[model samples]
Target chain A: MQDKKQLITIKGTREGLTLFIDELCSFNEAIKELHDKIIKNKPKKDDPIVSVRIKLGNRYLEDDQDKQLTEIINQANGFKIDSIESEVIRKEDALKWKEDSKIKAINRIVRSGQVLEVKGDLLLIGDVNPGGKVVSTGNIYIMGNLYGIAHAGVDGDRNACIVASYMKPTQLRIADYISRAPDYESDGVYMECGLVDEGQDKIIIDRLQVLSNKRKELSRFERRVQNG
Target chain B: MGEAIVITSGKGGVGKTTTSANIGTALALMEKKVCLIDTDIGLRNLDVVMGLENRIIYDIVDVIEERCKLKQALIKDKRFDYLTLLPAAQTSDKTAVTTDGMKKIISELKQEYDYIIIDCPAGIEQGFQNAIAGADRAIVVTTPEKSSVRDADRIIGLIEKEDMKEPPRLIINRIRNHMMKSGDMIDIDDIVQLLSIDLIGVVIDDEEVIKASNKGEPVALHPNTKSSIAYRNIARRILGETVPLQSLEDEKGMFQKVKKFFGIRA
Candidate 1:
């Protein structure tokens, strides 16, 4: 019977030593364990191979966090990093890895000169101030005001729409069509949605509730398939 | 330690150079040794603004490339014993001044001058980054215009991420008391609220400022007009003196001027 390791799993491959941190333990604890283990294995005064590789399985490492981990390994026992294998485990075309399921949600105000781009659906819970921009390949949903520029359906998805609490934007683009806000737009704050008008093949703006009703029907179709 | 301050306005023609020259001259007048550096290389205007264009035998590029000693590149202000102007390179571009080079130059100047005011060029490009490289503090200058205020907002956001010792202060330059009164221009409170920073000073629009610039004299040299008072107050505030915003604080005088101009009998 083999006892399960708590912190990390070390495997000696033909290339070099590979260290895998346990997912259950905290990152700080794993880092400390890795440091102690490297120092403990610091072969006497001379070691031929004094480097190891760290493979982070299915974990996103921010720049600073990666820097910290590398610094920890470098400063201890003269062991340098051979390679950092950031295995994100992305499964292309798998059942669970649907491209349409990807959604980017941001909850802060986008100020001037700020650019927010997303590949799939995007949901913004804050305002997009003037000089800001939001670009997406799929639908865009803004819970707050849209005072900046927004472009949806960038990759020829005409069905994609942009919904915002206030639709006074510098410019709006859907699929191949583009629309600019009229100079004399009403000053009232109202929820609105922008989408392509199939009949005219032009982008148009209307109340957000109209688009929400359409979304409700689409979700209803999805729910019927799931129930069956 | 001496503070290396950069006076930056993201938009052009918003009075950053004017603020730098005034602040430097004011600090020097207070008996503090000051060095005014113009980092707007290739498009140098600080010397012309200070009326010291004829004294620039050596520019910032000369000192950085080791062609001349630091002191040789500095043009001393004839009016003040403690003030000097380090002119920018007129022919060389902003790339000539590297951030690391600026850090070294600023550190060397720190040993001599009590305050180093860098006149940053407009735009958040190489010039902006180079000027801010060694700054311990920042002074963001802006006007009441929408474009100016928007750029100022962006600059403040950049300044926040700059990891400086302290956040930058705001100076609303060229404020017309009349425009503000008639609601044609943004108010001080609105500008402050939008920029979201400490309001250090508010300078009123004075015709004398243009006259002073032509003569290579900073407005702070004189103590008469509202422009002069505003610049002097800014200097006092920079020297750790708590000065109120004279333009907004004394609304009685401005109100009377507005009323007199419009011929309102009340």
Candidate 2:
């Protein structure tokens, strides 16, 4: 038989090396080719460690397959797997991700002693009175006063934020960071937002304008140009 | 059928008992047959406030437990022919009565009365639940203090979740006019907006209210004091009559009275 077509390709990039696994081949064949490529590219003991990123083109790897791939790369000297990227995912996982990104809108007073929770982004149209709490897995946007506790990014999304028209919250939490309202209170003349500052690893309360800059992706609609 | 109104404040000493007594008397003075039910159980005081404590031959527990007839347990007010009091059991706790029992008693009273005002106890416990069980309307009493207002907010939330015909109205009690004017206390507007409920009335802090309560006579019986007029106005509003809210401004001293008499500010 003619030499089997190559099922895996390796290339060097500015960051490090990249391994491309062919999707059309059987998983067994692809893994064998990947193992061979790692052995061929193995460096000498004196050479510095080089990171390798694997790109699985339209190929989904189960947990076992992924672990096997990682073990093969680690067994080769001087190669560390930085990350694995894939363009395709299982339908159930894709649906779960979509569900987590949805925005849920609610209207009514979150009265005292009440706890309102959402799985994704929360859009509240009424006040969160003192002693009340609002929690969300994604972002929280309140069109009314927030006089109570608000916890966003309950699933540890540091990029999530809490925005309120009147932000006199007793306490705010984003990701794992918790912050109490400062003694010097906001007159609440303008809307405010609270988010985790990655640099400082603290929750920061700032004017609403900061949301536009920090969370530009919050605006889902794209502006279109008009043709006259 | 008569409507039952539960007067409650989740915090203690926010004037719930006083409001219930005065509102019941006010409604009676307006010739509406009114029955005031003291639901405090172990800490009964509406009878004392109504000045009918000594006349309590049978208490609400006696009526609910079938130890006495409902009519026998109800004590007619010494002053108003249309007003009556159903005092709570001083020896028993709130656990002595069930919501079903309270509802049965209230429904029986509703058949013969124009209004049944249930004086709820402080704390959202068994007493409060028993108080609101058979009510058709709710009136949440609160003071201008932050803690009291906060508790009122909580009570309002609980009351709204109930299937009452009308939303709970607010009665901001014991407002210190001078303190409010000096900005030392929360503003009436701020309390109203924060609670976000219809304000039935605001009773200014007046010593006469305590003196009247001590004498077992509701301040609503007195016609001239600011507290009295506030209660009467609240009573008229409950009667479906439009009554303007009285200003909480302190009564003018003699000098200012003379100045105003001469239309100085006009």
Candidate 3:
């Protein structure tokens, strides 16, 4: 039992449950150790277990090795594969990954007939004029006016929201729901954020000050399973 | 190698051909050896605009098809010894000239000339692709209308997506001062704000543009006409000269001056 605990260390992370496979052992021993550990520490009814992230730790596994590793993880009753990450990634690959998560700031007027897409939080330092669009999978912040379509939560994350300087969006969409304000020009030049309301399941624009404390700029959501 | 620039406009009739002819002529006037290529193929007008239609014995199609030498196909301008026009094939279509063929021709031209200006065919198609293929930079043209500005915006986006290291410059043409003063036209500041590209030059509405082109003479050759000066300023800016934009409004004559003195606005 002591050897089993040393070979496999499991813990909860912001990105769901993570299991560390100790590199001090053989592949079969590691798998056996992980299987025994999971069986003994089975998730209780209130633990809200969904999936698992396996840390391979400096080892880049081949396709067959990954398949064998996944089969062992599958043996644990409730958890499925979230992802497999090697901590000490190749130098070039690490740079590429850093680029993907970086906040892309486009410092020009988003003109009509132009569409800008970003992976994470987008900082458009210029106005999105009529007929232009700014779409992102995560949160979007516009330093200038948002006169056009601004859609956040494109990949259906309800927490994602859009903050615009003018707040008068032609059409605002967060996740699956869309909101249109014909009279937004009345409030005119105020800064606001568009978020999905948890109560009504509709999109609402609140004052920017209220939502400032809950921003997740670089960290994407860990995979979550639906409640049964 | 000389800089190769493609002149493009997504919508037709915003003066892409005229700009190419005048810019090339202006550069040659400044003593730079300039070659202008018309990639319009079947519907070519650049040769006619430059007044080199009758001198086209061998066309670009001939050089690309390996039937004639490059010098044989280039029509030398009689006015300026340094300017040359590579006429598009009148008898053939865009398919006659491949993008790779254009790159090869442009690379060869780089060794001989100081500037290689390509007059791209309107619209984003095979002809546009072939023209922009060999270009080191791009110059997008547009007029003062919603439709034209929208098209220019799209063209600018396409240019930015290209592998060229520098973003395309914008040239606003045919701006009418009276319409602008009357609030019926989109002004330069508004258009520049919407397009969000570098503004190289602006051309005012003048009859000299139409009359000069009819005689197969570019406005830049005239040098004294209002539109001619505008085109020259554009050329100077392209040569890295920072010439301020000239106002399109007409100066008040004696009668209007007297009216203004009498507290009556013209």
Candidate 4:
């Protein structure tokens, strides 16, 4: 049994510690070995809780095998043994996190009647066609041309901004306020649009105009009153 | 193996019935044994569009409930040798046909026919579920208008939830080229971009479609009509033929040109 312990290996991952059960031993014996190893490696009472993942051979555990494993896990101390069914759990969790962190898109063109709604910041790798919409809770970033409606700061985050390679949106909304494109043809330039103030009370469209005039106006008024 | 295709649009009046009728007819014309099931139940119009409403003595409900045989309920198309219509019961509501009934009927039909085309009713209700219950693929129909496209988008999302092997293709119907060109209407690119689906067909807005529907004749039967041509082209594409999409802009003739000159837009 002491030499049998050398066959099994344990390593830690993002989710929990992975224990590789050796194929040489019967599934029941492997479960016993795993339980004993876990008991010996149990962390001190002051240490943080550690989770464990049991990895059986290529063949999936039978119903009877799972029952035996569960009994072993219950008997073990200071550690919880979880079965790693597939690699999908980790990948899906990562994908969910990626989706929540930012809105990433590789669309060639966003056509009319299409509404693309993202929870976080939106990053589109293509053009937003007329009548299409991109709504996000955070900042909106378009790698290509934007010719449709884009609403940033959907959850009322005033610091949110809309950036595009060619910023020619039909209508843009940041926080609460919205601004429509000028009627006449304007100089085609890559631009960023956002609200400069903390509360996002004003809408400003600028081609590299870092300090919004609206913000300057408020500050200038405050300075004059203070001097007086 | 026979394939089941569901034709659905979440919004009403976006040409789901019309597309179903035309596509089924076109498939039949191609000599594929096709059965078109109208899953709209109480509000069925596939029978009317296919010119078999008067002939529907026994409906899908009667067949599923074992009140009548499946053969007794199936109405064969007079014009097409390979096509049949399973009309929905006008007297009974959508609940009359359950998803299990639809799955069993479609499975039974799959053994006999090359294609089973379900004419899904508008809305993502029990009727829609019944229609898509055994569908192998789906074709979503939408118009250029905002409401129709929005509904189509919703339907597409629902179809995705079904976890079908293939994504549903999009059919943008009733596109008025003159209106689109004048910037008065939503363009095809915009619809495609928003839906993010492969284009199956684009049906132009034609007065002849209404005329054909009124006469209980599908527009696909009228080969000379532009809408008919569009339907036939869609059918050919469904048959896996590499056919170029017919340009809706090409139908803008002298009258449409005159309308444009007069600044009149639809």
Candidate 5:
């Protein structure tokens, strides 16, 4: 006979029942104690037991451990546990990580004709040449030359910025606005381009500076162009 | 050593079948026992290109389903002693030849032939899959166009997913050198940079290729044609020779330009 306190600890929350076991207690012992407790604390016949889940710490047990838990829950009398229903819920929750935005770092030159689409920020350590596309739902950061077409904030976040060491892309799109490299003179040096003021509609192409000197020149250029 | 090479282009009208026929004839001329298999099933053209359509009584489907023996189905090339053709079935669909079926047939033929070149069909469907099933290496054919390069890129990804031992080589076909030099066409470096694959061959756009194909003989079998020379160089490169890529700029000189303008015979 096992001690009741060493067997199991059951807590009911809005989501479902969480069964915990004390330190040094095997899963088999916990199962036996859970069966005994359910039999002793039987509620009204109309009120049914909804679900039972076991937790050790943060990570959930998979494969055989999941099977063992399901068997224990199904064996309990006066309440039927639909193992398949609970399994589906568990699987959906397990795959939640894939739905969240992730940062994918590609460390090679993306050649032309290659299309790379990611739901989060994309960081490339190499060049993105012509015919190659890098599209992201979030920001796009390239550590090397950006010669290909890129679309950042594809899901419509206008604040998204496309930053590259050398920006000479054939086409660039931020949120909704699309801009192509000027056909006359293409500045091949290291630069950055993003949305500026006036309803965040205009694209400002400028060199990167730590002390904001380029920002002042950009503003001066904008004012002169507007006044002229 | 024998190699199983598949000539594939994901998009249609990119000259995959034409390249395969020419390359097979070129390799056969080099004294290699080359067997060209048309895995396009119902849309077979390799037999017609090789001018052996009348000789193909038993097709690849008949060999796969054990209806006929392998040797009975193989059509010997009329021009080359070392060349043969395995025609695809015009009556059957793509499903008639599965990946496993292709593997079994190719592995059996690998022992006899010095080279087994498969002419893959267009698209990334079951026919394309079956065509590349038993290949030791692959050559993706593409024209100097955006759509062709895009499809070739997708096919490269699919080939990588199959876990091939080596990267699939690229062959840029039908390049019009004058257009490229005049900035109207994409350059070789542009394509090589975009596809990110090693280039094995580059064939110039030539009228002799069309004329020869219409005559049921590949341009590669023709003596002194530019496209034929390119195909022979490609075969030598496949044999591990260090052949230099022909400079399109150098070939655009006064005489060559005049020849190109007049559609002069090579």
Candidate 6:
């Protein structure tokens, strides 16, 4: 009884019941404990289905072990595994996450018919000529004129924004929303940013200053520098 | 040994054939052995513009398909002993010539000529691909119009993406003084800056160019017309000369002075 109690703990919260597997226990021991507890506390047949989440605190499970843990919880009557989360991740996944968060810098003109794409954020230092297109999964920062098409958050990230030194793009897309430039001429002096407005349900082009207000995370470095 | 320059414009009726004829003639007149290859295939007009239409005994298709030797297919220009023309086949389509065949033929011509000017067809298709296959340099020609500039931008993008030796240069053709003054036409500076390429020359719109083309003579044959001077300047620039850009105001001012001398209305 003491060993089983030390191996796993079950708690109920507003979200659902959570099964906290002890990090110090062996994989086989935790699986056994989880199976016993779920079977012992199985809800009555008339009771509603109880969604349970598993928390692997500081413990990493192989694919088969993770599947085995889920199978044990799901097999119990009236209970299903909602999610399985671990504090540790695979090295390849960590590297991919790092890469997706990194900003790619390109210095060249995006002429007509040319398409420039990046997996993460993009920092373009040259003009995007008419007929050219730029696509990124994250935010896009252009230090030159944008007279073509720019699509930010191509993977459907609605929070992604596109900022350009000259906001004369023919079309701007953020996530699922697309807005074409009006028939007005830009003075080509002030910078502008295109961001999605949740309430308005369309992209709005505003001054560059609005970027800091909307995307506070983008100014984290500047904030840290100022605080120091 | 020699440089092959492809003159391309993504849109049609923007004077690609006229530019090729004039530039080839200007270069040949400068004492360089120049070969003008019309790669328009079915729509071949460079030979017609160069007045060598009847002399084409064997066209480029015959040369590429190995039906005739490259020397036999080449028609020497009637005026300039050094200038030559390899006419496009009037009957065959663009698919008849492959990029590999073009590379082979261009390599052979490069060995014998100082400059090989290829006149590319309009639109970004197999014809464009075949035209630019063996060229070492590219000259994108455009006019002062929204659609023309847009197409020129596309052609420039295609050329640079191919990783050519140097970036393609720009030639803004058919610039009108009155339309520019009235702000109806796109400015030369705007086109150059928008395309973001080097500006080789800007040819003013002149009726003399049309007359010369109708007569099967390149305007560059006569050195006096504004259009002819523009083509000659472009040819010189191709030869690494540092000629100054021609100003529209000078020509307009000269016209105003002529009107005053003739006692015309102010």
The local distance difference test score of model 3 is 0.84
The 10 consecutive residues of candidate 4 chain A with the worst lDDT sum are A219-228
Better of 2 and 6 by DockQ: 6
lDDT of 1 at A1: 22
lDDT of 2 by residue, B36-150 (tens): 9999999999999999988989998998889989999999999978998899999988899999999999999999999999999999988899999999999999999999989
Question: Which regions in candidate 4 have their CA more than 4 angstroms from the true location?
Answer: A1-138, A142-157, A164-191, A196-200, A208-228, B249-266
DockQ of each: 0.28, 0.61, 0.30, 0.05, 0.15, 0.79
For residues B1-266, what per-residue lDDT tens digits would candidate 3 score against the true structure?
Answer: 68899999999999999999999988998899999999999888998888888888999999999899998999999797899999999899888899899999999999999899999998888998899999999999999998888788777777777899698999999989989888789888888876777999998888888998999989899968878888888888888999999878798799999999999978
- Per-residue lDDT tens digits for candidate 6, residues A1-228, read 554357888899887799888998789988887777777888999998888888998998888987788788778778877888788887987676766677899999998888999987899999998889999988899999998999998988888899998888889999889998777865543588999988899998888888778889775533322221
Each model's TM-score? 0.68, 0.87, 0.72, 0.63, 0.67, 0.89
- List the global CA lDDT of all models: 0.84, 0.90, 0.84, 0.80, 0.79, 0.89
Candidate 5: where is the Cα deviation over 4 Å?
Answer: A1-104, A108-120, A127-138, A144-158, A165-190, A195-198, A202-206, A209-228, B249-266
Instruction: Give the per-residue lDDT of model 1 (tens digit) for A1-228.
Output: 256465767888777788887766678888888778877776665656567888787676767978999987777655668988765643653334345546689886666788888886789988777788998887888988787898887888777788897777888988788888787845634787888877877887887767756545333423322321
TM-score order, best first, reads 6, 2, 3, 1, 5, 4
**What is the TM-score of candidate 2?**
0.87
| Candidate 5: residue A195 lDDT (0-100) | 47
Model 2: per-residue lDDT, tens digit, A115-164? 99998789999999989999998899999999999999998878789999
Write one digit per residue (lDDT tens) for candidate 5, span A125-225.
Answer: 88887667899876688998788898987877665567798888888888887888887965675766554334546656655552154234332323322
4 or 6, which is superior by DockQ?
A: 6
TM-score of chain B of each: 0.93, 0.96, 0.97, 0.93, 0.93, 0.95
Q: Candidate 4 has which clashing residue pairs, if any?
A: A111-B189, A111-B190, A111-B193, A112-B190, A112-B191, A114-B194
lDDT of 3 at A162: 88
The CA lDDT at A177 in model 2 is 89
Candidate 2 chain B, which ten residues in sequence have the lowest lDDT sum? B247-256
- Against the true structure, candidate 6 reaches a TM-score of 0.89
